[model samples]
Target: MNQPVSGFSKKSKAEKIEWLAENYLQNNLRSVQVLKNYWNDDPSLQQLHDDFIENTLSNYYLPFGIAPNFLINEKLYALPMVTEESSVVAAASNAAKFWLERGGFKAEVISTEKNGQIHFNFFGSEKVIEAFFEEIKPKLHSSIQAIEKNMKARGGGLLALSLVDKSHILEGYFHIHATFETLDAMGANFINTCLEQMAHTFEEEARNFEAFQKKVTYPEVVMSILSNYVPECLVRAEVSCNVEELTTKHHEGKHFAEKFVRAIEIAKTETRRAVTHNKGIMNGVDAVVLATGNDFRAVEAGVHAYAARNSYYSSLTHAKIEDDVFTFWIELPLAVGTVGGLTSLHPLTKLAFEILQKPDAKELMQILAVAGLAQNFAAIRSLVTTGIQKGHMKMHLMNILNQLHATEAEKEKAMEHFMKNTISHSAVVDFLGKLRL
Candidate 1:
């Protein structure tokens, strides 16, 4: 679990490194082995790599130093996230808290059977699936029956299936689709295993054709491998806050929320704006995904892919006013993990999980959803007020000033040239020299 002050100890770098290693490896040889094997045993290098990997992995705990006061459909939450953008936690937390201060941000998330997809190719004519579904759909029950020992015991089962026409990404090459509902598992391993077993049986039954691939899918997948992105399972969060709470500067969070709402569309954009836009979301999602050791890149890809789900690809979240109060919302596939991950091994990741007290999968999704929402708020706030580059460039110039040991006047000058948005270290140095400090 991450500490309230993550890495804020006044301990020496050496001591901090030791703490990280012990937490990450259980003092295992694996940490030392990988350290020596890959990093040439450079303590500094290993520490840096650990920081990057873990932050990239379990980095969700970094943002929101001051927790938000918000209610999701009347449920209370204290959200933590890891991101660099300004005003996200402050904005979302303040917004939610402001609403709750008067009443609360009430909302609901509808439920559905969570599922991934499987695709099979039989090397025969594409028309075969029409005749084949009648034969195989019945047998799918028996196959599910075999796996029911553990799943049924847990109060879940194979839910349903539907065959989809093949989608061709390549010329003259296509496949068939089957969506099987694996209840409550997040269905990563179970669905894939069951489908593979079913595919082998199909191959035997068909006898004349070859079965190529059987795997899960994303928002819309062709079946190479199934991502846990289940479009059918959507949880929508609706919220409300009084305008008095919003405009009160101190308590009227929606007052700012409205100003932000009208002005913040730049943050909701795709294209050049979408890069950092999505990056900020990853700041929250990737950290949670990492803490649980889920394949974050897959989750990352699916999220952006789904963000572009409509004719126009845009933001992961939406905000508006409702019920005489301000409201915010986000609906995206949150395929994050909770147990059976590298968190127990990676020192920082483990610590982050510790800070969170290791919330269960559903609870973890709530945390991640909050993070995504906050990150979105931060990005949009910046885009509307000044532009996304101002604060980021400020930090970049600060780093350059540190390296150059430039004077105060030189630092100020360098900051200006830097904010001109050149995005080069050389430009910072040139401005520093011109100051002659």
Candidate 2:
């Protein structure tokens, strides 16, 4: 029943945005079409649209919100995800519903842990710096040891250190990993500050090298950090529901689980299947990343690189039904932030963050982890039984017909559920009756 609207055609840009937000929340399904018109008039909206285009790298993008309708473990989240892959949004939304039908998702997050580095480069003179490197070693040892005195006193210390050369030069990089319990912070700024301190001290002490400019690589040291995104710290959500609630017809969940495992195995082992499979996982991860203003690109890099570690390039998650029950799970290498950078600059990102109720990074990561698992759950659940295209094509058809500018009759022809039929362009014309969206 969603029709293309023209009522806002006359409104100013700001008016349309205000109207779009209200109607979008109200579930007016054709808000996307309305958005195009609004974007034409509004500079701010255009900026958002442009940014999205750059971020997603696709001409096609869709945004939908996942509300934790049924919550478990006393947690509620409005998960927003954007992706073109079919079934992703529906799958995640459906999975969350499955959990919510019980008590809702219970999520426990480990404190955030950040690692910093100090890259030491011997620029001018190697001989002086070589002797100073030895002196600096003892100083570096004490400095590192003394840096986290209070943290060490609290039983968390500089976890470890590694020195690696950039190329042939003696450009050694100190790999510092500090595990902290950031109860509710993003820790990027905090971690960056910590790294800055080390870099400064390292620079000053490098003066002992005299002629050689032995300095700590500040920019490189803090460049792009690698997060300690332990999969265990992820939001683990479990649900229990009467079999009757899940389907119109009764299904033995255990059998479904077995099939799910096999499907996942196939998905991971096969190269083509794995692309779609991991893409399914990103359905959840990317959405949360977009909402949080985290770099989805970086997230994608880390996840894919990690996925390649075993040479098998396997799936990131697994699911099964056990003992008349259904359980779903996914593990992720998600490095996201709750503060700084894009989160602070983007308007929609700011609004989305507020909708999340300003959760600390730990809580935010939990939300993302759950979304990834939930999305994966949606994909495998369909593939094991109905097949992926069956459901996906349903939505795809609707979108295609809309784009084709089809009429009510042609739309109904495609919508007919009992029989599988294709509509020709001629048939579509016969059905056309001054159609609207």
Q: RMSD in Å for candidate 2, one decimal?
A: 10.1
lDDT of 1 by residue, 104-202 (tens): 543333444555555654344445555665567777557656766687676655666666554466433343344544443455676666666666665
Q: Each prediction's TM-score against the native?
A: 0.64, 0.65
How well does candidate 1 match the true structure in TM-score terms?
0.64
Flag regions of model 2 displaced more than 4 Å.
Answer: 1-64, 67-72, 102-106, 119-204, 207-250, 268-272, 320-326, 407-413, 416-437
On lDDT, the candidate that comes out on top is 2
Candidate 2 colliding pairs: 70-100, 71-103, 71-104, 71-105, 72-103, 72-104, 72-105, 72-106
What is candidate 2's TM-score against the reference? 0.65
Give the local distance difference test score of model 2. Answer: 0.59
lDDT by residue for model 2 over 1-437, one digit each (tens)? 34466765566655655565566546464654555543435656556655643222112335646545524357576776656655667777788877676556555554344455555433333344455555555455466555556556655444544443343534443333434433343445555555556566557765444445334322133343435443323344334444344553435555566677788778768878888788878877898787777878867876776666687787776555555565555556555777667777776688878877787676777777777767777777787777777677666666667877766777785578314644444444444544434
- How far in Å is the alpha carbon of 227 misplaced in model 1? 3.0
